[model samples]
Target chain A: MDIVIGVDIGGTKTKIGLVDQNGECLEQTFFRTQDFPNLTNYLDQIKITSDELIQKLGKEVNILGCGIGAPNASSKNGTIENASNLVWKESVPIIEKLKERMPMPMRIMNDASAAALGEMLFGGAKNMTDFIVITLGTGFGAGIVANGKLIDGYDGFAGELGHVDMTLGDGRLTGLGVRGGLEAYVSATGLKRTIMYMLSKYMVESRFRDVAYNDLHGEDITKAAEEGDEIALKAFDYTARVMGLALANFTAFTQPEAFILMGGLTNSGKWIMEPLERYFNANLLEVYKGKVKLMYSKMEGKTAAICGAAALIWEIQDKPS
Target chain B: MDIVIGVDIGGTKTKIGLVDQNGECLEQTFFRTQDFPNLTNYLDQIKITSDELIQKLGKEVNILGCGIGAPNASSKNGTIENASNLVWKESVPIIEKLKERMPMPMRIMNDASAAALGEMLFGGAKNMTDFIVITLGTGFGAGIVANGKLIDGYDGFAGELGHVDMTLGDGRLTGLGVRGGLEAYVSATGLKRTIMYMLSKYMVESRFRDVAYNDLHGEDITKAAEEGDEIALKAFDYTARVMGLALANFTAFTQPEAFILMGGLTNSGKWIMEPLERYFNANLLEVYKGKVKLMYSKMEGKTAAICGAAALIWEIQDKPS
Candidate 1:
């Protein structure tokens, strides 16, 4: 059976996996991308890992294609433009670079878009024709699907749901140039800020204050909320409200079939999903009230990224030029 | 060339026209719907007019089909359920009734969707595969085209752009029960309300104060604006700002090739169009900026609606059940 090698490149770690036509993963592996000195060495390690996975899965499983998902990846130009997270010094022609070592047709897309494609292919939204996949990790991101097709605007940068206006606070004068946006409230930084604001109001003691800036993760807050913490619940509720309002604004025009939520904060499960679902329904137009479903990804967290990356490549190849 | 009869049934009047494949109106006629005592008489008038037009055009132009466009047309059901404006109290099996007289294939569709199809076929958006047609008549309405096709959704009521929130005044609400929508400022009702609000504040007035609600039209306001009226200009600017923000919100998701503005008020031309175009460009997502074109429809006034209604019928016949 023909298979595709899917790669998910991040600042800290890089994940690789073999995906079949049915979106089933055969063998998956991971390595620290930061360990490599440069792009060449990093890609060499990836090739070695790919070879190992192929050997384990049997050499008869021909690698038909390769798909890579990364920050600032441009599907139109087939390049990975300089990303602040990655150590790369210059724009990298990812498709061309991968061709030299692997010798197969390849495609690369933004990680958020890949995640959306993954949700469409193997996640809870497998049967949905129109939906938006939102990633709430370090920063909020989204991939939009309309009329059963992925929307890549003139510049291949169509889905920017996070950047849409949501805030009405004094902190609008931040790094992001936009006036009001969803990213201001839903991202990891946004959650940290929310926690800090709450801390000033209440004399609370928690593990969050100790590792506040350096090593604190979004999951810690979710865990704290799971233990019946009020502050954490407030933060989650705030994020869900803004996300829901933004989704309502989006549904006004496209009216998608569903919204698929992912990323680290989504692990909060009902703490985040239930409120988000409620607010989204409340804000929806009467005709669209009971139409859109809110779903969470069922695939293992790691597999979702790679599967999404693979789906991006598959989708690009299938579309008419 | 084969010809088709395109019938546009409005609340107060009915227009019947013979349209060719090239979208040319070979022969046309109109009559006041109030003249007919009942739907039977109204339909008989249409039959008589159509037969006369067909006879005048001669046997050389064979009528191949018929298309109808109305307010509450259900493409799925091939009938126009009772429209609020129309006196018809029961569902009109329009196609089945009209078919007996014409002896040709017939189809029916809602007016807004038909307008979208008309724009796609012969208006300013002729060559584009993806775009939106915004009708700014008594009420604000829209028909969206994405991925080269109109979105019918699950219930065939997909493109409802007017009801989306605009967030102007807290008291303003959409037909869907949402507060602060585009229709609050962009439609004919919206413009009149805006003018009335301005009248309470501004001292300058020329002709609007004594005008009857029925006689108050967008053209009168446009004429005043052209004559250098301050209140008219302010009203246009305020309307433009609201429309611009709404357009920005829409382009954030479904980045259609263009937004074609139609209906009565769009005749205000540069007064409304210039400011709206300016604000749309200034506020759009940086990536989507300049990608979407704002243009007026080549079909203006009642003729466009007739054409749009006709196109709806043609579209229904072309689609498979």
Candidate 2:
């Protein structure tokens, strides 16, 4: 039996799992990422936890490699550069440090890209050679797959579709300080912004009217829209319009077979998907109409992150260098 | 010495050339495409012209394959589908017919995609694996190369950047009847539209003011801008702003090393290039800033088309199936 170590490094918690060739998480453990302010301590803890997980298995297993999903990670350089969410503000040579202890093949990519690989390896995009995996969480991120491989581009910074300008500087500014980006209109933060904007513009009766801006969650909006809240419905509609148009523009670039969406926003289900599909079809160029399908990620939540990270190893094994 | 048959099928004329592996045209011939109303006759002429060019070489040379660049061509199916510019409105099995007569390996791609392959094989993008070729002719077109391969997408209709919506339906209508597309604001037709719009909006004295809409040409706009005509310069400025911003959005999709510009609009020289570069840089996301270089295509005019078509064969030979 062969198993690979999968690591998902989040802003707060870090998950480490032993994933089998069948995309099954045999065992997993986690630690508070913020607990280790020092880089060396954090790496040491990861090693300790990984060793314990392997020891607990109590069965003979060939360790294949390790795959990590982190913020601002570069697969080309095997480093994380200036991740806003992580405690480390500088470039971290993660792959190098991990290899010293693990003594196995390893790969690292940003969480979104890892998820894309996961989708390709074990999710709905299993047979797709060309598609896009959109991560709609606190921010927008995408992993573009073409010719059955991820497009790392010249500097391994390809598929930053979230930052693609949407409003030409006229719309809301994103956390990155860029104005009118797709991230400013299509992410969780963007959804909240739209809700706030609509609340001010329209006098629709809604539970969100009393909720504070920072306190409001994406789930609250989804719940409200489900119960026929006008403001919440409008917000979803607005977000869908922006995303649909952007996806249409994206279609012109690659004409992928489908766009597989994941993350918090997708939980809104028909609220976002219905309008998004309608608008996407409406905006697509004539040649591409009714051709591209919109789909949801088969994997869910934390399980998705771990499986996606593990998928990195499986992906590399299949491709020739 | 190995040579390939290169064909550039244009709306008005068709150019056939015998090109050596070195990207040199040893012999060439032309015929008016409009003269052949039937697809069979048109394909037969191509075969006849190819044989004539090979015979004229006057020496024994290995004919490797044939590469074709035409409107709405599909390399996957070896056919041309519903090209608006061509008189034949139905799908034409061009490669199947041509191969029957010539009996050689053949490939067909849209002209813009062929140009991208050309750039990779023998032009500015020779050293760069990731780049884009933008054709700013009567209409806008792009050829996206990532990971050392053209992104033909699932249906072989990728890289239609011109049809990417720019205005969400509020802007000018493109000839394809789509409103607010990048084509409506950045092509040769778009430049003329800009001039016309500027002339109507402003009382600036210019050579274009006296010229009728149909009489006006893209070169005239370039010449006028060269002489520092206010309206002409402003028109170039307007066109560049739209194009620059659109390119910035495109940059986020695939962070290519450079964007190679070609066609009539590029003839505007610094009038378009200067402000265009400024806007492109200004609009780029922080991560992508100053990373993507803007360049002009090395090959020019009819020679470019022929060589680009020839490059397709060379490109395939370099890659293993």
Candidate 3:
């Protein structure tokens, strides 16, 4: 079967995998992405990983396509345009350079958009035409699939749902001048803020207090919530409320069939999902009360991101050149 | 040239017209819609108007289709559901009934959806693939056209931008039963409330005091503003600011090409548009600071609705049916 290589480049780690038609990944490799000083160095590491994977497979597999999923990748420009998390000076032509090195048809998309396509192809929202996929990582990120197609508007910046203002009046302030953006109260950073507020109010002492501010991770907080920690539970509750209200607002506007929640924090499952479902149902239109289901990503472990990036190639396989 | 019959059914009037492929209305007629107590009466009036129009202008014209625009119409079901202003008891099979009466293929869609399609086809957003059409009438309504298609979700209930809860805290007692909704703060009824609040704050008396509460009209307030009234301008400014912020929030999410403003209140022009534009620009993402445009609808008066309704049929024509 013809296979394509999928590369998911993140700030902390990078995943590479070989995927075929049905979104099945045969083999995958993981590496620390932060070891590289610049993008070219990062590309060199990716190339080495890809070559190693190809050599280990034995058979000379036909490389049909390649897809790169990066943090701030601009699909329209086919470059990673100054991802603050990644050490890039300006726009990095990863796709162009990769194409020259491997000599195969290739495309690149933002990580959230790629993850959304992966969800539509293989994860919770499989077979659904209209849905939303949100990556609840460092900051909340969203990609919209409307009327069965990805919403890549002029300049390919259509589905920035994370920036949709959540609070109206003199509420929370976002990094941007805008107040109450979805990311301001729903992302990993937002969750930390929620936890700090809860900690101050409840006067609770926890292991989290010993962790450095920058080192405080979402996984650690989720672990705390899973252990029935009240402060962590409050944090999850606040995140669920903000996220649920955001989802309800999005549903009222777009009326999607489902909302697929992804990223690290969702590992807490019932802690976040149960409360989110409750708030979402309460806030949704009466007719749409139970129609839209809130689902979690089915794909887990190292292969999900690479598998999603590979799914992007399969999606555009039949498109007119 | 192939032509289509466009019909706009409103609470007080029913407008029927012959529209050509170029979106030009060749012949038109209007009748009192409120006089009809049953669906049969309404259908019969349409029959009378259709026959008269055909008889006056040769009956052998190449009529391509018929399209109806109505309040609370469902593009998915092709029915006019129970609209608050209408006397209908339940959902009316508008498309099927009209097709039977006229013996022609027809389609039906919501007035807001039709207006959005009209703007895409013949109004200010002629070349835009992604834009929102906001109708500022009795209620705040929106029709979102994204990626060159109307976002009719699972139940054709998408693009309810008006119902998105605007109030943040204890929304149950607020205007839309959950904080501030676009309709709660932007519609004619909402604007009336704004005027009333302003009147109480400023303790001003004008022609507004002369008109009884129930009989008060949106135009009367606009006329007062037109004659250089401060209280009326303040009322308009509040609406403009809120609407501007709403648009900013919308653009951040969808990143549409433009915002095509329609409906009656839009007649106020700069009184609302200037401040709305200012607030919207101030709150937009940095990259999108000067990118998105805001424009008024080119199609106005009764024909606007008719042309907009006809656009649904034109849209279907371009689809792979």
Query: Best by TM-score, which number?
Result: 2
Using Cα atoms, each model's DockQ against the true complex is 0.25, 0.59, 0.52
Cα displacement (angstroms), candidate 1, residue A176, comes to 5.4
Candidate 2 Cα outliers beyond 4 Å, as residue runs: A10-15, A28-65, A82-106, A317-321, B11-14, B29-65, B82-92, B96-104, B316-321
lDDT top scorer:
2
Q: Count the backbone clashes (under 3 Å) in each candidate.
A: 2, 0, 5
Query: Candidate 2, residues B90-159: lDDT per residue as tens digits?
Result: 5788888888888988999988899899888888888898999998876787889999888998898888
Residue-level lDDT tens digits of model 3 in A29-116: 9888778877677777888898888888878698888888776577887887656456665668888887767888788887778888
Which model, 1 or 3, shows the larger TM-score?
Answer: 3
Q: Candidate 1 on B110-188: residue-level lDDT in tens?
A: 6667788888776776777677788877567777776667765544556666666554123466444567766767887
Indicate the worst ten consecutive residues by lDDT in candidate 3 chain A.
A169-178
Clashing pairs in 2: none
Question: What are the iRMS values of all candidates?
Answer: 3.8, 1.6, 2.0
What order do candidates take by lDDT, descending? 2, 3, 1
- What TM-score would you give candidate 3 relative to the actual structure? 0.88
Better of 1 and 2 by DockQ: 2
Give the Å error, residue B78, model 1: 4.6
| TM-score against truth, every candidate | 0.81, 0.89, 0.88
